[model samples]
Target: MNIDQLNTDYGIPGNLTFATGKGGFPMIHIDNGKAKALISVYSGQVLSFQPATETTDLMFLSEKAYYAEGKAIKGGIPICWPWFGPDPEGLNRPSHGFVRNRLWNVLETATTADGATKVILGLKDTEETRGIWPQTFELAIAITVSTTLTVELITRNLGNKSFPLTQAFHTYFQVGDINRVEVLGLENTQYLDKVDGGVEKTQLGAVAIANEVDRIYLNVTNELVINDPALNRRIRIKSSGSKSTVVWNPWVTICANMADLDDTDYQRFLCVETTNAATDIVEVPPDGEFRLEVIYSIE
Candidate 1:
């Protein structure tokens, strides 16, 4: 709980802000500004966010990709690949599957013997990803934001051979309304809709999230509930190695074409994603090493 090192000036100019976020871990390393807005401050609870700015900005505006950190909703932490949506098999070779536009390197961060405040983001297996799927891998992304905000996705398989893949952490949450919300523990179970596009629905009980709700819940064993009755609290969305769970709400024409979103920002926000991707891929094998962990509690 000692994460300080900021100096606002997203005004941009020669940018090279290193990165450091530990105040309690919601994220904020604006990297000398330039759209480095990972600003959640953990919870002062504002509304409109997305200030990452540039560095190739792959469209997720808060200001638009600042240092372009790994990826997060429109905030920070986005590492979905091989397939999370679209191209289920249409020349699937790129786009949203190489670790969010690729560019993560910040290996170790400290203080955690019960003090909690770690931050290790990494990715490897280059040479153009073993030429579109061969093997050799090492992708680690660990984040521990004190009170609440723990995102981890570690997969290592330095190729001896085996290395199957399919992942997701495309989580985009920022709610206050989204129709008052209701995602409590997926009652029935079974989802996979992608939009009206994939279609494979199920869960028909305690999980009300109105309109454009994309599904992808299969064999998932509980750990979700965004019942944000307008921030009264209740955002516990836990997950382990992963079984399957990807609920979304882009309603209202994708929030009016998203320009930083906020035509009511889909009422506020909801993109409960915690997946293993497509048919739940993760074959590690070779040197073996596969993991996925996400926690954002605020009950």
Candidate 2:
């Protein structure tokens, strides 16, 4: 476990800690002594970040955490790279590709010019990975935490070859009430409704999830607000390098079928994903780079 400890004063309460596993993979965990994130300093797996202050959490937690062995933390923001879900072409491959489930390395860490601490987590293709997609690549994922949390994915081809992939942060947010919460900013946008089994439609008024919802909106801008009236707080989502937004809530019957997901957990969480799907497929030329960034702040 190669853990990169964040810069801190001798006894400061909460500070950041970054790590790389046996092969120098990247993962960061924060512990202010108040909210201890149960993590492995080596593997980039956020096994658990639940604070004791809250009894029930809305974080993404794997069914049974096996941090030392590098099982991708099931829930949370599993960075789906090269692909999302099952490939429509069909294969014996894993879901969302192998990035989340595999271990990554800590490439570098430094304070940013804006006074924010930036830690870059990196993962390169091994001979084993080449079997799946024979492309030499470098995926650098940087996380900066200040008043808000910013997760950035910057990919480059180091093998003198082109790389094409689909990706997302798969962010799961904790909410006070699914009913009282309404997602604003998608008023005039158009979305491909998945609940109707992949039909396209334009959204009307503010997006509300009174029932099951799954729609992937195409050509998005930089803002989304989760108006949690019950909690009297707003969860703001801002993004760059993305042209899509996927709002999903596995409501009603779907919630009960997910063994890893708590049945009634729907009441406390919502997945308003920031993505570049649909007509927004990202392609990187040989030796070229592409970046997609997403930032979330809760108030």
Candidate 3:
């Protein structure tokens, strides 16, 4: 449906509305008194979110991000599905799967009991998708906007055979400054440092960003906290159905090289993803499903 049709059919008066956003993509704007959020139906991505109590948004979006078709936006909670990172089969397919770039179907919208707004978007296997991964599956992302923002990603196997899957809610959080941010709950966890040739290392203390960092932390705790002293608030992340997590910041050198990000964009955001990556893959059985959920709240 077009933006007007979507608004006419699914919009909640004074709460949720649909309109054309950057790059001419259909966007969902939500404001239910407690918080405000923006979602892109084109990428099935949550572009921005902020509770009424906070002055700044919880998510970071790069101003230079590509809004065109087939290019993933530089920030927000991008859904990396079916597979994360490089193609496992060594095909020249896009990194982090193709779902992030495809348009999603809006399935349902509702107002929850506590006055929260919920939106569910779906994507099923198509001829074009099957041509890339050949897996028959259905994927849905149910997003709830309340005082706290919650996102749940559901994956169902439609084929008779089981399929291995690795995915992530690659969340880019906006911070006053990257240097003033320290991630808690990852202390003592072992991770594969991608920046250091994928060497195995253990986190000894709170994660602090001083330079380029790309690590897949394994067997993580259920809850993590981003203590942003500059922002003067702590963002807590609670996740379920995920044993692994990813922490990344493309610091100065790499930040200068990315076309979708400004040279200083790296200093304004931090990625502490909830994921099932590296060796923590899950196999979805035929007719069965898996869920990855995360809740974000600030204090």
Candidate 4:
């Protein structure tokens, strides 16, 4: 469904309201009594989320972020589906699949009993998706905004055969200072270093940033807390149906080369993605479904 149809069907008081956002794409601005959020219909991406108690938004959006069709926005929660990171095959397609760069149909919207707003958006496989990755599938993202922000992506296979899949809720978190941030929960875990040709290494202590970091922690089931000393607050991240957790920051060198990111933008944001990558690849059976979800809250 297009933006007009969505506005006509499920528009409610203190729920998703249709409006044009960056790059003239239709977006849903939500204010459901407790929290506020912005979701882009183009990618079903939650671009901003802030609870009532916090003065700052939990998610970050790049100033130079591209908002045009088929271009991935720099920040927020970008869905990396069917495959994550570089082309799984030798096909040299987009880095994080094509789903995030396409329009998603708004399927449902409602206010729950607790006055939280819930919105569901979906996308199905067509000939265009098949040309890149051959599969019949249906993908939907369900977001609930209240005291905490919840985002869940559900994938269902529509084909008769099984298919391999890897995905991530590529979430960028806003922080006061990247240098003063410490990520807790992945300590004593082994990670695959993406910057060093996927070499394996074990984490020694709480993750502290001093330089470029790109690692995927394997088999993690713990809740992560971003301890921001500068902000004097902690952001809690809890997830389910994910085995790998990715922590990344471009630092100085790579940040300078990215067209969509400002050189100093890396200082204000860090990515701690809930993912299924490397050895945690998922095999979806015929007519089967899989889910990846995460919750962000302030403490």
Q: Write the per-residue lDDT of candidate 4 for residues 1-299, one digit (tens) a residue.
A: 35576678878855678887788888999987698999998988999998888888999899999999889999999999889999989689999889899888888998888889999999998998899888999999999999999999999999999999999999999989999999999999999999899999999989998899999999997899999988888999999989999999999989999999999999999999999988989999999999989998899
lDDT of 2 by residue, 1-299 (tens): 42334323111233565544333443455654334443332333334444434443435454433444444554566677777666634876776677776656656655555645555667889998888777898887876645456778888877676766777877777777888889999988889988897888898888888889988898888499988877666777889988888888888688877665677777777888777676778888888888988876665
lDDT of 4 at 255: 93
lDDT of 4: 0.91
Give the better candidate number (2 or 4) by TM-score: 4
Off by over 4 Å in 1: 1-28, 31-34, 39-120, 123-137, 140-156, 161-166, 180-199, 202-208, 211-214, 217-245, 248-267, 272-299
Per-residue lDDT of candidate 3, residues 199-260 (tens digit): 99999999999999999999996599999999999999999999999999999999999999
**How much is the lDDT of residue 109 in candidate 1?**
55
Q: Model 1 over residues 10-76: C-alpha lDDT tens digits? A: 2122332333433223343333222222433332111122223312221123333233333333544
Tell me, what's the RMSD of every candidate?
A: 16.2, 4.6, 0.7, 1.1
Q: Number of clashes in every candidate structure?
A: 26, 11, 0, 0
Off by over 4 Å in 3: none
Query: Distance from true position, residue 144, model 2, in Å?
Result: 0.5
Instruction: Find the 10 residues in a row with the least total lDDT in model 3.
Output: 1-10
Instruction: Please list all clashing residue pairs in model 3, or write none if there are none.
Output: none
Report, for every candidate in turn, its global Cα lDDT versus the true structure: 0.60, 0.68, 0.94, 0.91
In the predicted model 4, the residue pairs found to clash are: none
For model 2, the superposed segments whose C-alpha errors exceed 4 Å read 2-14, 18-27, 31-71, 112-115
Write the candidate numbers in order of decreasing TM-score. 3, 4, 2, 1
Instruction: Please give each candidate's TM-score.
Output: 0.34, 0.82, 0.99, 0.98
